[model samples]
Structures are given as C-alpha cells and as structure tokens.
Target chain A: MDKTQNNKAWFLVLPVLVIVAFSAVIPLMTVVNYSVNDTFGENEFFWNGLGWFEDMIASDRMHSALGRQVLFSAIILAIEVPLGIFIALHMPKKGFWASFCLVLMALPLLIPFNVVGTIWQIFGRVDIGLLGHGLASIGVDYNYTNDALDAWITIIVMDVWHWTSLVALLCYAGLQSIPQAYYQAARIDQASRWSVFRFIELPKMSGVLLIAVLLRFMDSFMIYTEPFVVTGGGPGNSTTFLSIDLVKMAVGQFDLGPAAAFSIMYFLVILLVSWVFYTVMTTLDNAETK
Target chain B: MMRARSSAIVMTVYLLFLLIPIYWLINMSLKTNTEITSTFTLIPATLTFANYVTILTDPSWYMGYVNSLIYVVLNTLISITVALPAAYAFSRYSFMGDKHLFFWLLTNRMSPPAVFALPFFQLYSSVGLFDTHIAVALAHCLFNVPLAVWILEGFMRGVPKEIDETAYIDGYGFGRFFVRIFMPLIASGIGVAAFFCFMFSWVELLLSRTLTSVYAKSIASTMTRTVSASGMDWGVLAAAGVLTIIPGALVIYFVRNYIAKGFALGRV
Candidate 1:
C-alpha cells in the first residue's frame, strides 16, 4: 500500500493541511497564549506562567466538574452499551421489521441537541410534560429543576433516549456481517442460545463495540448543548459539567486565562483517551488481519 | 424459555419508551396551543395547523430555515471540495508524514466545540467575516473536512488499483481516470460522507450559535430565542422541532442503506 515514490500525491493533501492549520492549530496556539498570560482590556497582556493551570488543578470547582463529567460519561457507557446490545439481539434479523426498527431508531439521532433538550424539557414538566405529570399523578415527587438526583436522571434518560440507537445500529451492523456458516456451525453443535451469543456473537461484535465505546466516550465527555439547554447547569452548579463550567468562566465571567488552561487540559484528556482507543482498535485490527 | 420471554418484553418496552417522545412531538405539533398546554390529551382534542401557519407566515421563523439552508449548502460544498483531494492522497499514497497528518485531522474532531467558541469569534472577527453564513460554513468545515477525508479515505481504499492502471494504459490522464473510474466506484461513499457533513453542520449549535447573530441564524438557534414574555411557546417550539426533521429524514430516506453503512463505520 505504500506509494511514497509518488511525491505528486502530496499536492492533494496540501490544501487540507493549510485549512486545518488556520482553523485548529492557530486557534489552539491562541488558547495556549491565553493560558500562560494575563489579559486586560485594550489587548494588554502579562505573563502568568503556569499560574492558571495550578489554580485550576487546585480549585474545588474544577474537581467537582471533572467528577461530574466522569460520572456522567461512566453512567452513559454503562447504560447504553448493555441497552443497545439487548436491542440489537432482539431486532429482527432480516425483514421489513428490521428496516422499520432501524429507521425508527435513527429518528432520535437526527433531532438537534437543543431540540432534544427542549423535548425532554417539556416532557419532564410537572404540569405538562408527560413524564413529570404521569409520575406525579401516581404520587411520585419528581422535579428536575429543584432536585440534583432528578436533574441527573433527566439528563441520563435524555442521553439514553438520544444515543442508544447509535450503539444498536452499530451492533446490528456487526451482527449482519457475521458469516452464515458460523451460525450454522453453532447450530450443528447444538449450542444453546446463550452459548451462541457468548462465544460467537459477542466476539464478533467486539470490534464494532470498541468503536461504539470510543465514540460514546468522546461525545459524552464533550457534551454541553443538551444539558445546557435542558438545565442551564441548574439549581446552583449541580449539573455544570466541565464544558458548561468552562463556558461560564470564559463567557459569563470572562476569566479567559483559567478557561483557556482548562480547555487545554480538557483537550489533552480527550487526546489521551482517544489515542488509547485508536491504539486498542488498531491492535485488534492487526490481530484480525494476521 | 422464561428468560427469552422476559428479554422480549424488556426490548418491546424499550422500543415504546423511545417512540413515545417522537409521537408526543408530532402530537403537539398538530394541536392548538390551548390544547397542548391545558389538556393532557393523549390525542389532540382538535387537529390544527396554527403552529405551522404561524411559523411559516412569520419572517423570522421562516428566515431561520433559509439561513440554515444557505450555511449547510456552503459547508457541504466546501467540505467535499477540500476533503476529496485529501482523502485521495490518504487512500492512494504513503507520502511524507501521511500518518501524522491523518492523526492530526482526527484531533480536530476530538476538540470540544466550546473550546473554540471564543477563539473562532475572534478569528472570524479579525478577518471581517463575523455573523455571516460563510463564517459558520467555514467554521464547520474545520471539523467536516477532516471527517469527510477519513470516511472517504476508507471507501477509496476499497477500490482496486487495477482500474487506475488500466485507465492509464488506455491513455487516460490522472483527471480522467479519477473522474471516470475512481468516482463511480466510490459514489456511495461520497454520498454517505456528504450526508454526514450535512447532518453534523445541521445539528451543530455551540459553534453555529456563537458564530452568527442575524444573517446566518439557524432553526435550532431560533428555537433558543423563542422564549419571551409570551411564555415558552411550547406548541410552536414542537412544530419547529418537527419541521427541522424534514431535511434529515428526507436525506436518510434517500440514502437509507448508505446511511446505515455509514453509521456502522462510525463515519459521523
């Protein structure tokens, strides 16, 4: 596959490099500049060294935000991975029903994040929202705007509703790719349904599931718009994940130095995890190829 | 046997749970505001197009649709143009620093949109392109182009090299070979890539909302500003949400198979 002898190919990639440099690299450098320096009105700057990073690392606010973010992502991965697999298992193998279910599943993914937030926002209203009203009528006390647990549940449920389909669809695709001979062989051996799933389907699905995990992890880590629209980080800073807190610092409070440092740290964390994902997936790819 | 039955029951309940909100949206869209707010009617007490009529007739609401379309088209076109060549290079060559460059593109995808919100505003403003459709389009291209390149590269690699050689043997030049042979082979791939580009740009808010104010505002942005002294306007908001689905749904219907394939690959 190597074609390094053909230097002319470099011309094709030159434009993309330029565009990315301007958009990503330059702005990143600006962030780095902001991170180390103090800025005042009229474009004045003062060198602050690693002060912002130190402050952020020591701050209780940052610790709580990071904790909330990690917990949120962990809970998301837990609920979605299992739920999606279950849906994929029960989905009709090949029929009108399969297509029907797939298209329906994709419906949630297409809705805009703000709108998804709005739907759950309205749907969780104690007065009008179906969930809130329905629950209250049954004598359960539930209010997202007031209770932290209720807020967390609403956000988690909102995410599950929106994203589980992606995991399901990916798993379904993996299932579809399984060779019929493998299934026939399992059947010939008089394998139980559980054994068939555990031995054959589970291993086969692992490849796509790895991808699902990576995507979900990256997405859940960066999630801001839905939670923002739904809760506005609410009833105090209870639901303010890292991204929400960063925005509040940068825009709301205009603390550019701390926000910039936090963003760099945020980017680094994502980069580290994404690299781990890439390395793992590629290693698996190599194993499969071998 | 009992476990299977219970599993089936669990999955069915899950499906209904997923579908009810969508049904509620459509249900609310059809109902009058009074009906939506007052009655907890499972079905609309009376079907009405008042919400749709209001949104369509109002310049502000209708203009949001137009602005969104303009930026989406611009984003798609720019993404495809830049991405095609980059994808071609990535797929066909092992040029200097190719692996590094490929990974670098992915880093753009991983960076949180919020991180870039302030810097993008400053970057665009310095260039005198603030609050324009082109600004949003260009900002989106930052992520879309990389995604397009990665997805398209995967598809392009699947095409046989023999065709390129055959085209060359027949005296076809690079341009002809790429247009006549390479393009048809990867048409479905490009279609899927284009759809992803459109979908991401369409749904994006943090960047889009930050970049534009008046001329290039999107439907999603309009939904945000809908909250006023008149109250939250749930009926109109639901209608807008339902209407926004039209473009994505239409795209999905046409390329349902490709969309499914694209999703399986995690292209978007």
Candidate 2:
C-alpha cells in the first residue's frame, strides 16, 4: 500500500479542494469575522475583541448545554456499541435471512432524521400515539412533552432505535471478513466459545469497531433534527444540546457575536476528539499490519 | 442446538422492536385522521388513500420530493466525480501535504453543520445562489467530498498498483485506464460511496432548509411547516413521513451487500 512520490497528485485533488474550500473555508472565515465583531441592524459593526469568548466562557447556558451533549453522546455510544455487536453476532451470515435482516434493520437508518423524530414524537404521545396510550392503559405514566426524565428516556431510546443498525452492520461486515480457516483452527484446538470470540473475533473486528465508534460519536454529538422535532429541547431546557442551543442563539435570536464564538469552540472540541480517534485508529491499523 | 435456538429468539425479538414503529407509521398513514385519533386499532379500521392523494396532487407537497431528489442526485454526482481523482491521488501517490490535506478534509466532515448554517446563509445570498438547487448541492460538498474521497481511497488502495503499471505498459493513458479498467474494478466502491452520499444528503435538514427557501425546498422542511401550521394533520404527516422513507428504502434494497463491505473496508 506504499504510494509513490508524485507531486502531480495535487492536480488530482484540486477539484475536491476547490469545492470544499468554497463550501467550508469561506463560511468558516465569516464565522471568524462575526466572532470578533459586534453588529446591530443594517450590518453596522463594532469591535468586540474577545468579548463574546469571555462571555461564552462565563455563561452557565453554554456549560449546561455542553454537559447535556456529552452525557447524551456517552450514553448513546455505551448502549449502541454493545447492543449492536450483540445483534451482529446473532445475525444469520448468509442466504435470504441475512439479506432480510439487513434490509429491515437498515430501514430506520434510511428514514429522514425529522421523520424519525416525528415517528417517535407521535409514537410517544399519550392520547393518540401507541406507546403513550399503551403505557397509560397499563397504568404507567409517560409523557415526553412534560416530564424531563421521560423526555430524556424517549430521546435515548429513539437514538438507539435509529442508529444501532449502523453499528450492527459494520460489525457484521467485520465478522464476515474472517476466513473460515481461522474458525477451523479454533475448532481443532477445542477452543471454548468465549475464547474463540476473545482470540479470533475481537481482534479481527477491531478495525471496523473503531470506525463505528468514531462515526457514532461524531453523529450523535452533532445530532439536531430528530431531537429538535421530538422535544424541541423542551419541557424546560433539559433536552437542549449544544447544536440546539447554538441554533437558538444564532438563527432564532440573532446573537451573532456570541454564537460565532460558541460555534468556534464547539467545532474545536469535535475536531480535537475526532483527531484523537483518527490517530488511535491509524496507530492500531499500522500496528496490526506490522 | 440450544445456542442457535436462543440466537434465533433474540434476533426475532430485536427485529420486532426495530419494525414496530415503522409498522405504526404505515398503519397511521393508511387511516383517516379521525380514525387515527379516535381509535387504538392495530389495523386501519378503514383504509384511505386520501393522504397520498393530497401529497401527489399538490405541487407544494410533491415538489418537495422533486427538489430533494434533484439536489441529492446532483451532489452525489459532483462529489464522486471530484473525489475519484482525489482518492486516486491519495491511494497511489503521496504528494506534498498529502497526509495533512487528507486529515484536513476529514476535519470538515467533523465540522458541525450548525456552525456553518448562518455563514452559509449569508454567503449563498450574497452570491445570489440562495434558494437554488445547486447551492445546496455545493454546500453539501463540504462534508460529502471528503467522505467520498475517504471511502473511494480505501477501495482504490485495495486495487494493486501493478494494474496501473500494466496499463501503462499496454500504452493505455491514465484517463483510458481509469475509465476502462480501474472504474469497473472499483465500481462497487463507487456505488457504496454514492449510496453514503445520497443517504447523508437525503437525511440532512438544517443546512438544506437554511440554504433553500422556496424553489428548492426539501421534503423534511416541508413536513416541519405542516406540523407548525394550524391544526396538525397527523394522517397527512404520517403519509408524508412514509413517502420520505421510500427512496432510501429502494436505495438500500439495491446495495444491501455492498453497504456492509463498504463500511468494513472504507474507513467510514
């Protein structure tokens, strides 16, 4: 896989670079510009320096949103990874059943994020929705619109339902790549099922597992639409994560300066975490190959 | 035998849990609004296609679907076309800043769409591309191009360098070899990349909604407006939601096997 030295490769990458730069760099610069300047109506501006950053640092609102976001992502990763792995392990490896399982499991993933939110929103309603009415009929009180705990549970479950299939599919693919000779060797050694999983399967699946973790972490952290539709970050600001809060500040209220600063910091955190994941994964890949 | 039986039972339960909500949505879509609200029936008391009729017959409703498809298709085509060469470069030759460039592309993929929402709104409007299909398609490239490169690079790397050498020995130029030989070899990779691009573009709302208002309004945003306006038409909303799932379902059906292979190999 070692590549040759060819500076002309730059030409190959130019088209992507131009498109991404237009889409990413220009807007990013605007955010930076807004972060440093205060503006009133008619696009009139004043120097704000680090005022917005200072205010963001001192604000409890941003802190709470960050806290909620971290907790949500952690919970999602903890649940989805193991549950998805379990589902993948149990899945039929070949034939019609495998295709059937894949198609059905992948359905949630293909649905629009807002539709997912709407489905859960109605499904969890007390009067008309099935889950809500069923819970009430069974003498269990549940209302996502009112109770913070119920709202949190519903969002978590909704996320799990929507995304667990992705993890399962990735792991299933990882499992499929293992050669049959490996299993034959384990059988010849009379290896226990646990040992077989521990020795043969886990290491083989690590590459895909890392990819799954990274993807799930990034996506869950940036989640906006589904939760926005379902809870509107509501029942009190309890469900308002970083993205929701940022949108409220930037678009809803037009606090451009603070929102810009907040966004820079938010983007940095994701970048740092993703960089760390990327480094670790690449290191593992290199080590495995060596 | 016992273990296999338990595995089957567990999978059955898991599948049911996955399916019930989708089933509920479909059930609601088939029922009239009155039936949907008044009764707790597992099956529709009386099936009605009025909701579907409403969507199909209305320009505002059905155009949302058309708008989404146009941009998604455009974005996928542009992303893959641009990414193929970039991916080839990364796979075959390590140029100056190659590693840094690769990582930087990924950082864009990691960048939160919310951060860029306001700036993109202004940027597009200033250029007079706002509310246009091309604007959304271009804006989505920030993420999709990097991803397409990442996925395509993985597939390209899997193809031995010897092919390029052999093609050269056969006096085939880079363009000819790429189109005639390399493309067919990595066709599945392209399919997988296109599928991922389409999925992300299809599901994304905030940016697409922010960037386009009328001429290129997406179905997701249209659904949101429906929920907010006056009395909520639960039946129609459910029906709209059901329709939104159709395109993605069709895509998944076609690429079921490639999807898993793509994920496992493509650094997704």
Candidate 3:
C-alpha cells in the first residue's frame, strides 16, 4: 500500500483536472463575479462589494431556510444510518434472496428525483392517491398540499423511502468484507450476540457508516427537485429549504447579487463539512492499515 | 429460530413499504385518465395503454428519453475515461498536492447543483453550447468526474503493485498493461463507477435542465413542464415516471452485486 514518490503521476491526472476545471472552476468564477456586482437591465453594473452578503446574513427568510436545511439533514442522518445498519444485519448473507433483496431495494435509488416526487405526489393525493384515500377512509386528515405538518411528514417519509437503501447497501458491503475467521473467533470465545456486534461488526462498519452519513447529509441538505415537485415549497413557505429559496432568488426573480452571495456561503458550508469528513476518513484508513 | 423469523418479518415489511408507492405509480399508469382522477381504485378497473402510446407516438415525449440517454451515456463515458488515469495516479503515486487535489475534487461533489445552475447557463450560453447534448454532458462532469476518480481510486488501490512491476518486467508498456491486465483486474470497479455516474446523471435535474432547452431537454424537465402546462395529466405523468424507472432498473439488475461494494469502497 506504500506509494512511490513519483511526480510524473501529474501526467495521469491532467485530463481530470482539465475537464473538472472547465466544468467547475469557470462557473464558480462566474458566481464569484456576480456576488460582488450590481446589475440593471442592459448589462449595466456597479460594485456591490459586501452588500449582498450582508443582506443575506441579516434576512429572516435566510435564517429560517438554513434552520430547516440543518434540521432535515440531521434527521436524515440519524434515521438512515441506524436503520440501514439494522437492515444490512438482517439481510441474507448469500443466496438468491440476497440478490433479490438488493435489486428490489436499489430500485428507489435509481428513479429520477422529480419522478420520486411525482410518485409520492400522486400516491399522497386525497382524491385518487392510495395513501391519502386510505387515510381519509380511516377518518384521518392527511393532505400534503394544504397542511404544513403533513407536508413535512410526506417529504421526510419520501426521503427515507428513497435513500435508506443506499445506507443499507453500503453497510451490507461493509459487513460482507468481514472475514469469516473473525466470526469464528468470536464464536469460539462464546461472545454474546450483542457483544459480537459491538466488538466485531460495529468497528468494521465505521468506515462505510461515515461515508453513508456524509453522503446522506450532503444530499438531503441540497434536496430541491423532489420537494419542489411534491409541494412547490407548499401552501406557504414551510417546506422551502435553502436550495429552493436560492433558486427562487437566482432563477425566478433574477436577484443575481444576493443569490450568488448565498450560493458562495452554501458552497462554503459543504466544503467545510466535507473537509472534516475527508480528514476523518483518511485517519480511519491509516488506522486500518496500521 | 425466533431471531431468524423476526429478521424475515422485518425484511418482508421493509420491502413492501418500498414497493407500494412504485406499485401505485404502475397501477396509475395502467388506468385511463378518467379512471385515475375520478375514482379511488386499488387495481385498474379498466386498463389502458393510451399513455404509453401517446409517449411513443409523440416526438416531444419520446425525444425527452432520447435526449436524456444521449447526455447520460456521454457524461458517464467522459467521466470514467478521464477519471481512470487520475484515479491511477492517486492510487499508486505520491504527486504534488495530491491530497489537496483529491479533497478539492470531492468538494465539487458536495456542492449544491442549484448554485451552479445559473452560472452554467450563462457559461454554456456564451460558448453557444446551450441546448446541446454535449453541454449537459460536460456540465455533469463537475460532479461525476470527481466521483468516478474516487471510486476508481479505491478499486485501483486494492490492486497490488507487483502486477505493474511484473508487467514491466515482461516488457509490457504502461498503456498495454493498463488495457490488458490492470483494466481487467478492476473491471468490476469500472462497472460500479460507471453505474454511479449514470445514476447521478440520470437522476439530476437542475444542471441538465439548466444547460439544455428544447432539443436536449431531459425527461425530468419535460415531466415538470407537463405538470405546469396541462394541469396534471396524472395518467400520462405516471406513464412517463414509469418509463424513467425502466433504464435505472435495468442498470441495477446488471450491477446489483457490485453496487454494495461500490458504495463501501468508494471514498471510505
């Protein structure tokens, strides 16, 4: 696993760098440029400096959207990680059943985000949708379109349904990587089931668990299309998250300066968290190697 | 005995929960538009394929699928092709700023696509690549290339250095060894990476929708426009949704085994 010191590796990486720079760096520069300028209709512009950033920071709407985004991400990570681990543990180790379960479970993940929203939207409709009609028949008031709490629950459940398989699959792979000898040793020691899970399985799954949490968190925080399709940010602004709000600003209203500033801040938060996760992942990798 | 029984129950219930909504969509797709809106029926009382017929017959509807496939395949191909060399370098060699570079690439994956939507629109427009398949394909590489590199690097690191050394001793050049021996060794990795690229590109709407208009509009955007314009044609919408799920289902069927490992190994 020890890598040789070879600067010539740059030649190999050059293609990726060129491609990513074209796609990422150029657009990113444009966002930065827009963040500092004020513009009128005919491409007229003036320097806005920190005005947009200041306004974004002071706005109550921004605060609420950030609050909702954080809560959503936290809830997603908390639920999906443990639930995924549980599902993975229960899954058949090997058989036709394992393959069947995997393929079926992965189906939700492959569906388009908007379609996922559309499916849930139709499935939760009061008139013709199954869930809504069933709930109504049972004398429960459940309308995602009209009620804020209903909207929140629908979005959360929809997300859990869509993404839990990802976590389970990752955990299942982690579990599979554990050598049979480890389980044999645990059995020889007469380890209890809880102890076996605690000592042997939990530690082994930590790496994949971290990856699952990071991915789930980032994706949930940036979620837009599904919720947009489901409620269009809802009867009010209750379901509007950061990305939804930002899209309204940047694309809908053309408030370029504020949106660009908001975007930079949004990008920074993800960058910061990912950097932390990266550091932890590397540390874990090194520990495993050692 | 008790534990095994409980595990089976748990998995059965979980699978049912996952399938019900998809089942609902399919059920809706099978029913006529009038049946879909007027009544609450678990099964289609009168089955119809008119929605599918409409999509297949109409250029606007079916071309959405074609446009999506073109860009998605193009993006996947470009991402994996470029990422292979970068992943090889990261896995095997210690280059300048390698760690920083890797982290930076990953940050793009973490970026909210909403942020890039506007700038990408203007960037592609200025270059006159707007509404073109290549524009969307290239735009997607921002995230897909980084992901492909990360996945491929994990798989590549698992291959021992001895293989490369032996190949060299046998008079195999770098390119030859890579194509013949190294690539075959990591074929599953490549498959997993390509699947991930395709899945992300296929599912993403913001960047693709932003970068392309009429000629290259994806099915996802097309579906959205349908909802907005026609006051919700539930049956046809369900049919389009069902069709969109087909390609992904096919992909998952082919790569089900690798998918778990792909997630566990990539960036972990």
Candidate 4:
C-alpha cells in the first residue's frame, strides 16, 4: 500500500509522542545521567567519566552473569522451539479439539510472572507438593532450594511450562495460514511425511519461527520475576541471569554508577541482537517478495 | 492411521505435562495448611475454600487486585486512545521520519524492563506520582503503546483507503468520520489492542512493584510479600495465585478467536 505524503499526519501522532517522551525518553535520560556521574547523599554528584564502564567491563561478576544469561537463553531456545513446533504439529487442525488445545496451551502465557514463579514454587516443594512428593516417594532426592542443578532444571522447566505455548501458538497460526491446496498438491505428488514437513510446513513456518525465536530470546534474556521468586537467584547465584544481577546491583546494593553503566550495556546488547533479527526478518521479507 | 494415533498420544502427553503443575496449584489451593504440609493426598482429604475466603475478606489482599485493575484499565484506555491516531497516521500517510519513529517505538518494546526500573522509580517519585495507579499506567506505556500501534496499524491497513475517500466525499468531517465511520470498521482491532495492553500491564510486575509501595500495590506483589510470622502462607498464596489466573483465563475465553491473529501483530 502506497501512502501519500502528509506532514500534517504528525498532529495525529503528537499524543503518542508526548506520552512516549514522558514514559520512555525522560527516564532513559536519567539512566544515562547516572551512568557517567557519581552520586553521594543529599543529591551530591561528580563526574566519573567512563570509569564505571571500565570497571564493569573488567568485573568478574558481570562476566559470570553474562555467561549464565547466555547459557540460559541458549538452553531455553533449544528446548522450547523444537518442543513448541512438535506440539503445534500434532495439534488438531480445526474445530472443537483445536480450540480446546489452543485455549489450554495459551493458559500459561497469560499468568503473571510472579504467579508463575509462585505456582512452580508451590508445585516443586518436597513436603506436600505433588511433583516434589512424588519424586521423593520415588527416591529421586530433589530440592531446588539446596541444589544448583535442581534450581536450573526447575527454572528451565518452569519457563517451558510458562512460555512454550507462545511459540506453539505462533507456529499454529503460521500453519493455519497455509492454503489447503498446497497440502493436497503434496498428497497428489505422493510426498513422504518428512518431505511434507521439510518442504511444505517448514518453509511456511519459517516466518513465524524467527518471530518465536526472537521473542523467546528477548524474554528469556530479560527474565527476572519468576526465577527471582522461585530461587531468588540462589543455591548460590546459580540461576542469577542478567536482569537479576542488574536489579541486585542498582536497587539492592545502590551501586548506581555501575548499575547504570550495566543498564546501558544491557540495553545495547538487546538492541544489537534485536537489530540483527530485524535485519534478517526484512531480508527474508524482501526475498519472499522477489 | 498409525500417524493419527501417534499424534494423539503425543498431544495427550504434552497437554498433561502442561496441565499437571496448574492442577497441582489448584489441588493445593483447596486444601488446609495442615493437609498441605503433613499429608500427601492426591485429592484434598477434605475440600476447603478457606484460602479463597481469606483473600476475599482481607482488605490488604483484595485491594491489590483493585489497584492492579485500576492501572491496567487506565493503561489500556490511554494506550488505545493515543495509538489509534498514530496507527492511522502510520498506516495511511507517509510523513517525515515515520519509518524511523515506528522502528524507534518498537525498540522500546524490546528494551528490558529491568533497565528502566530504577530510573522509572526516580522519575515517578520526583513527579509525586509514586505509589499511584496512574504512575504505573503511564510507565507501562513505554512498551504497550508501541505494541498497540503495531497491532492497530496492521488492522487499519486491511481496511481499504476507499472508505476514507467515500466518507470524505459524503461530507463526513475527519473527526466524525474517524469516530463514527472509521472506529466501527476497526472495532475488533481496538478490542485486540486493548486486550494486549491489559495483558502486558497485568502480567508485568517489575515496574509496577517498583513504582508503588503500598497505596497502589499489585496483587502479584502482595502475593510475593505474603509471609506470615509462621513462615510462607502457602494456602492464601495459592488462592491469590488462582485468583490472578482467573481474570486472564476469562479474558482469553473472550478473545480466543482473535488471539492468534493478535499474536501475529494483526497479520492474518
């Protein structure tokens, strides 16, 4: 759709601009101010230049948290993407069962992050919770509070429970968009089941798959509340992802300069990665059109 | 036949896996604390609504839900009111920096809430809006507005431009056309946008919790801070959790049809 030139359209957009300036821009400026300056009590401040950034860049804490964050995001994508596709593939194509499956699968995505944390917290308790009690009765000796591996598994599983529906739902929508004629053509050609998935469904799903992966990556990278409530980033900083670390630094310890520097860097990394996904998505769109 | 059977089995297993934890939460919510801690009954030995009773009767507890609803409603109304015109502008006209503005708006959606927590805290506090429902609503606009714009733009694009021209030729003014003619055409889009706004605002806790301490505390925060002298109040906590899930579940039921379309950012 070709849009006509209309500078007057800015009037229509002015309201959004005002709200955004207050909501996003002003607060962002504050973050930048805190990053370069040192603050003392009574609103005293001094120029520290790029010293905080240098310190944060050299810090082992940031490195480990980044490492853990990367690993966590990688693990989440690995498990959820494939599993979501599998679930979407098997979902009934339409009618009663399809609606039932969709409504149920979407349940987790709608729950509050903290409630999601609390659900798993209660569900994984060893005393009376079914999962923990069931496992203990079976003699698996599982405890998320005391063990690193258990905490990791619990967070990962909780995330999968909380979010895989999103990917599945997106893929399901993508699958729904495929014309029936394509599938009938494949059947007429006597295509193998694997070929049907690879040559037909896979190509169709690529657009949404990238979206699923990007959303999953961004959300997983910024994850804080669920894991915070479940493990409080504990069993000794084992589940402490980037957001957890930043919150602890800025709010918990009041290390404003470092936290501010960290925030800028954190925002940049997400921006950079998102830019990559955006570029790739546009390239694909262009190729598709061509 | 074999493939059909296999798919059914796989779906059954996966569905069970997705549902069991929720089932467990439900199961715990119906039991007494004594039974919750001491007994291992799959079914509640004696069903109880005492936990739900506790949350409903307690002012401190239920107010959290009210505060959450207030801000969420405010955020949705504000997001849609502003996003409608902006979405229309972007979809219908090419203005200077329109593409850059759209891209910039989206970048905010991807910006981590963790990054803005403290600055938002300061920004709200300085303006004397801290601990107020409006504070959180405005703060949430950072992400929700972009999404509403993106989703609404997609919906608006699907409506042909000839409608606008037809309305103009009929002597319908811009305001009248937009309100009476254009809005009804995209009423479903508005619902979808409002639903997304409500969802993101409701589910978000970091900025909401940070901005409000007591006067306008969120239910999720109330649930998190739920500690009795004895220790964790598992029964009441689970009930609060269940209550939070109910609103979302109801909303999902209403929007089940548009949900996939909305998730695709209004693309069909």
Q: How many Å off is the CA of A185 in candidate 1?
A: 0.8
DockQ of each: 0.58, 0.79, 0.85, 0.79
Tens digits of per-residue lDDT, candidate 2, B68-95, equal 9999999999999999999999999989
Clash totals, every prediction? 0, 0, 0, 0
Best by DockQ: 3
- Local error of candidate 1 at residue B134 (angstroms): 1.2
lDDT of 3 by residue, A1-290 (tens): 99989999999999999999998999999999999999987998899899989999999989999999998888888888889999999998899999999999999999999999999999999998899999999999999999999999999999999999999999999899899999999999999999999999999999999999888988998999999999999779999999999999999999999999999999999999999999999999998888
Candidate 3 chain B minimal-lDDT segment of 10 residues: B259-268
Tens digits of lDDT, candidate 4, B41-124: 888999999999999999999999999999999999999999999999999999999977887888888999999999999988
lDDT (Cα atoms) of all candidates against the true structure: 0.86, 0.93, 0.93, 0.91
**What TM-score does prediction 2 earn?**
0.99
**lDDT tens digits by residue: candidate 1, B1-268:** 7876875686678789888888888888888888877889888889889999999999899999999889999999988888888898877777778777787788788788889999998999999998899999989887888889977987886777777778899999888888887888899988988988898898888888888888878888888988643677888998998999888878877776665567755322
Cα distance off (Å), candidate 1, residue A218: 0.6
Q: Write the per-residue lDDT of candidate 4 for residues A95-158, one digit (tens) a residue.
A: 8888888888888888999999988988898886778878998999899999999999999999
- Clashes counted in candidate 1 amount to 0
Give the distance in Å from residue B251's predicted Cα in candidate 4 to where it truly belongs: 0.5
- Candidate 4 chain A, which ten residues in sequence have the lowest lDDT sum? A281-290
- In model 2, the Cα lDDT at residue B219 comes to 96
**iRMS of every model, one decimal?**
2.3, 1.2, 1.1, 1.1
